[model samples]
Target: MTTLARLDQFARERKRAWAEGTRRAAKIARERLRSACERAGQRLWRTLSRARHERARDLSKRVQHGQRIVKVGREHGMNVAAATVNLTRKAWRRVRGLRRPFVRAGRRVERLGEQYGALREEWAVERDIESLVDGGEPILFGPWTSEVGYEALYWVAFVRWVKMTYRLRTDRLAVMSRGGVSAWYADITPRYLDIFDRVTPEAFAARTAERLVSAGTAKQMDLSAFDAELVESARRELGVERLRVMHPSLMYRLFRQFWLGHRPLGFLQSHTSFARLTMPAREVRIPDLPAEYVAVKFSGAQSLPPTPDHQRMVRRIVGAVAERYPVVLLDTGMAVDEHGDFGIVRTPRIQSVREYLRPSDNLGVQTGVIAGARGFIGTCGSVAWLAPMLGVDTQAVMTDARFLHAHLHAARWVYRTLDAGRFSPLDLGGFARFGLDVAGASELLADRPS
Candidate 1:
C-alpha cells in the first residue's frame, strides 16, 4: 500500500483504541460510584433505625396516622379497602438486606434487554418479601392505598391459596405475597383453562358461533387476520407502525371497526356497546385470612425453568418445603367483581403481614386479587415465592401441564396433568377408568430419582 494509506489506517486504529479505552474507563467508574452510594445509603439507614428506636413511641403514632388511611372510604361502599401488614423484626431484617441492592443491580443490568430487566425487578421485589418474617405471625408491610397496590395484595393472597389448597389436610402451607403479574400469563393459561380457551373470533365480534352464520352482513376474522386489519387501521389513524405494535391485544381491533369505520351506526354492532355483553374484570379479589388460619407466606426466590416438567418439579418441592411451616402468604390475583365482595376481605379488620414497597405504580392496579380463606394458603406467584427464599417452609402446588415454565418451576405439590387427565393410569384393567392417589402422587414427586 502507499505510505499515505498506511498512515491513514494507523490513525484510524489509534482513534478506535482510544475510544474503546475511554468507554471501558467510564463504565468502571460509574459502577464504582454506584456502589459507593449504596454503601453510604445502608450506613445512613442503620443510623436512622437507631434514631427511630429511641423515639419509637412518637414514631409509632405517626405510623398509625399513615396506617389509618387504610380504613378511609371503606364504609362509603366504594368496594375497595386499604390495608397493610406489620413486619416483624426478623422480616424487616431480611427485607433490608435484599431490596436496595437488588434494585440497583437490576437498573444497571437492564441495558441488556426488557426481559432480563423485568426479571431482575421481580427478583428484587421477591427479596423484599423474604427478608420479613420468622415463620409464624404475619408480617404486615403494605399501605395498599391505590387500586393497583390493592391488586398486588390480592395477587399475593391468590398465590397463597394455590399453594396451601393442594394439601388441605396437612398442617402447614406456603404462598407468595409480592411481585408483578407476568405477560407470560396472558400467553399461557389459555391452553388448559376453559376461561382462556373459550375466547374465539366470534366472541371478539360480539356474536355467538351460531349467530355468525345467520348474520351474513357481519364480517368475521381469525385472530391473526384481525391483527393485520388492526395494524393497517392503526397505521392509518396514527401514521406510524409503532402504534400498531404498542397495543398488545385485539381489544383495539373491534374498537377500530366500530368507531373508525365509515358506518355511522357502528355502535349498534360494537362489542362494548352490545346490550348483553359483560366484560369480566381482569383481576380477582384477595380473600381474608380466617381466625383459625395458620398460614405462612414467603418470597425471595429466583424462578427456575420455563418448561412444563421443570416447573412441576419446583411445585413438588414447594409442598414439601411448606410442610414445616404452617402459615403461608402468596402474591397471586383472583378474579372478583369490581364491586369487591368475593375475596380475602370477608370479615372486619384483622392484621396481616405484607412485605414489599408499594410498587402499585409499576404494575397496573388490580394486578393481583384474592378471596379470603379460613387461613392463609398460597403458592409462588407474588409474595409466597419470596417466602422460601427467606427460609420459610412452603408446600408448593405443582401442575405438570402448565404452559409457562416459570409457574411449574415454583410449584411444590406437583400434580401431573396427564395423570389428572387419565393419561397416567392407576390400573390397566380399564381404559376408561383411571384412578388418582394424591398421596402416591406426592410420594412420586418427592422421590427425586437419581
Candidate 2:
C-alpha cells in the first residue's frame, strides 16, 4: 500500500519485461542466422557429396566400434554410456522425423516439489494403485503387453511390491499376458488370463507392430486400441461388467527416472521389490531331451544383434556346450516381437524345441524347459535377466550392450541381493576367454574372433 513498495514493484516489472523482450529478439536473430547457414550448407554439401558421405561413414564406424566395447564388458562403459544419454537423445532429435519420438513426455511436474522429478511420478503411481484399491471389483494385473524379460524382471516384481505394500490376497487378482506364463504368477494368483485366447497370434503381432510405431519405443507406455480390446475381451470371458486394471505403464513410469539417470538406484529400490524369480511349475509337456541339457534362447536383436560374425560366435558357443551336454534351443518358432532367433545350428547334439511350442503355451513350455535345464545361455537382454532368478546358471551373450547398460547394472545387484544363480555375461570380445576351465574350452577360445 506504500508508495515506495509500489515503485519497487513497478521497477521489477519493467526489468522482467525488458529481459523477456531481449530473449525474444535473440531467439529470432539466431533462427534467421541458422536458416541462412542451412541454405548455404545445402549447396556446399551437394557439391562435396563424396566427402560428406565419407565423413558420415567414419562416424558410423566409430559408433559400431564403441558398441562392440560395450558388448564385451559387463557394463564396463557405464560412465561413458550414461554420459551419452543426453548426447544420444540430441542425436535422435537431429534425425529426420525423430523429434516427436525423442520429445519429453507431457508430464507437468514443476509444482510437485520434485527432487529429481520423483514426487510427481511417485504420486501418479500411488494414485493408480489407489484406484485399484478403492474399486471392489476383481483387479486385473496385466494384459502384460511387453517383452517377457520385462514381465519377469520388472512387472512381476512391481506386482509383488503392490501386494506386499497393500497386503492384498491372491484370490482377488488375475493376470493377463501372452503365452501361458500362468506359472510365473502362480504365487500371486491362480487366475491367468491369456491374451492369445482373445486375439489370434497373427493379429496380436500386427497390432503390437502398429503400437510400437505409434509409441516410438518398445516399452508399452500408452494403452493402445488393441490393448483396450484385450481388456474388454477379458471382461467378457470372466462375465464381469467392470474390471479394475493395473497396466504395465505404471511400472514403466515409476523406475524410468533411474533408467534416465535423473534419479538414483535407491529411488527404484524404495519403490519396487527385487526378489528372485521362483521356478514356474513344469506341468507342460516339454521335449524329451537329455536329463541335463543346456537351455539356449539367443535372439539377434537388442543386445546380441544379428551379424555374420555374431552368428558364427553363437555357433561356436552352442557347439562347445553340445560337446559337453545336449543343447535345447528355445526358439519360439514365430516372430514374437522385434527379436529374431539365432536360427538352429546344424552341429551335432543340438536340438530345437520350436516345433513343440504352441502360441497358447510357448512361454510355459520355454519356462518348463529352462527350469529343468542344468544351465542357460542366451542373449543378454532377454531371458538372461530371468534365467538368474530361475536358479539356473546363465551365460548371457551379447555383441553390443549400448542399450542394456542400466539393465545389466540392476541385474547384477538383484541377483547378488537375492543370492540367486551365478550370472556370467560373455561379450563379443570375451568369447575367447569364456568357460576356459570347462570341456571344449580350447575349441571355443581357438575359434573366437582374433
Using Cα atoms with residue i matched to residue i, what is each candidate's TM-score against the true structure?
A: 0.20, 0.70
Query: 251, model 1: CA deviation in Å?
Result: 25
**When superposed on Cα atoms, how far off is each prediction in RMSD?**
30.7, 19.8
- Give the poorly placed runs of model 2, Cα more than 4 Å off: 1-118, 280-282, 429-450
Return the lDDT, model 1, position 169.
21
Candidate 2 residue-wise lDDT at 417: 91
Q: Write the per-residue lDDT of candidate 1 for residues 1-450, one digit (tens) a residue.
A: 999999999999988996898688669857865775576567556655655554565455545754554455355444442222332343455445445544544454453344334434433433333333223332221211112212222233332332232222212221111123332122212111111122232243343222245533222222244334444443443343332121111222222222233223323122211111111222333244332333423222122223444334334433642343222233223221111111122112222333321332112222221212222223333433322322223233323223223233222212221111101211111211354334444454233210
Q: For residue 174, give model 1's deviation from the true position in Å.
A: 30
Q: Put down candidate 2 lDDT per residue, 219-284, tens digits, no spaces.
A: 879777887888888888778888888888888887777776767767767766766556643555
lDDT of each: 0.31, 0.73
